[model samples]
Target: MRELREYLAACERDPACRAVLLTSSAGPFCQGLDYTCLLGLSPDKRRRAAEELARELKEFVRAVAGFGKPLVAGVTGACVGLGVALLPLCDLVYVSEKATLQLPYSRLGTVPEGGATHSLTTLLGHMKAGALMMTGRAITGSEALSANLATGLLWSATAYEDLIAQARQVLDNAAQIQALESTKALIRHSLRAKLEMALHSECRLLVHQWCAPEFQQRVRDLYDGGQLLLQKPGFDTQ
Candidate 1:
């Protein structure tokens, strides 16, 4: 979080940097939290960890919301949890044809983060947002495009490279226009304040939810159900 925030700030200050493209070279883009890291902590420590995470998340979203340049995201694989929530915040999103987006907060006994409660509702209306947040359903790239979550789709055959090339092409063209930054500022001006407020609320809720017994049990259940894998270099569970 700190690294990303610093990079964003640096980019904002750099006159040569016009726009930024966010993408992952690895598969699955992002799979949200590694539950294995949290599952072993005692309830008290767990709550502390959650608080730290909440703080980081709030600051990260604030940076993203305040960015002056056009922000584009390219999703090449599964995007879950925080990944899914981030889609609505970006100025333009491009996804691979095989990409999948899911918000499993309800299933995890938690709520949305990254100002998703406000952003998703604003972008996708009450019914659609409710369906996604409440039910934990996975939506395909085509579905996301249809719902206006994605600006366009990339062919899976060359999705990663295509997304990167396309995002650069688009952003480069946009950067050439002198009014792009001002236009973006105008577009985001009204939404920034509410997004910050929503981020605070959502992050606070996440801290509380992560420490709850139900959420803890759900993590255990996920492991038992073969949904999560425990990596090595295990921490002390005491």
Candidate 2:
């Protein structure tokens, strides 16, 4: 998160950075919180920690959503939890055909954070959002494109580089590009006020859910089993 913040700050300062691309290293974009890190914490400490983490996550999403310049996300593998949430805030998203996206908060007995519930519903609608939360289903990149979660789909990781090149080519036309970006800014500005309210509300609910016994039990199950109980099958290591 600190690194992401620093990168964004640099983008803010650099006039040449017209579009910022976000992607992970070798593994999945992110598996969300390191459940192993939370395994040994007491209930109270866990609750407080979750609250703090949720607040930081909310701020990050807000920053991405309101960034004056366009933001791009390249998702290669597991894009779950806050990963799925944060991508929607980007102006454009590209995902590998093999990538899987999920929102596993309900299965973990915690409320959705990072403005996922609000933002996802706005993008995917109430029914699809509810299905995702309730079933904890993993959707493919092609499915994500169909659902409007992804703007483009790549056949392989190699293809992702080509897509980035294409994106850069389109952005290289400064005058035409700047005009389109200005229009986008105007549209995004109109939605900013409501998005702020939704983000704040999500933080509040997440804090409360973090303190709940059900959520604690879910964490305990993951700790005791050495893996998250509700994790999607193929991704579980243990």
Q: CA lDDT, every prediction? A: 0.79, 0.73
Give the per-residue lDDT of model 2 (tens digit) for 129-150.
Answer: 8888788899998999999998
Query: Which candidate gets the maximum TM-score versus the true structure?
Result: 1
Error of 2 at 187 (Å): 2.5
Superposed model 1: Cα runs more than 4 Å off: 175-178, 228-238
* Candidate 2 backbone overlaps, count: 0
Which runs of model 2 end up more than 4 angstroms from their true locations?
35-39, 42-44, 173-177, 223-238
Which candidate leads in lDDT?
Answer: 1
Model 1 CA lDDT for position 147 = 88
Question: Model 1, residue 34: what's the lDDT?
Answer: 61
- Each prediction's total of clashing residue pairs, residues at least 3 apart in sequence or on different chains, is 0, 0
Scanning candidate 2 in windows of ten residues, the lowest lDDT window is 229-238
Q: How close is candidate 2 to the true structure, as a TM-score?
A: 0.85
Across residues 47-161, which tens digit of lDDT does each residue of candidate 1 receive? 8888887887788788988888778888877787777778877888898878989888888888888898999889999999999999998999999999888999988888877
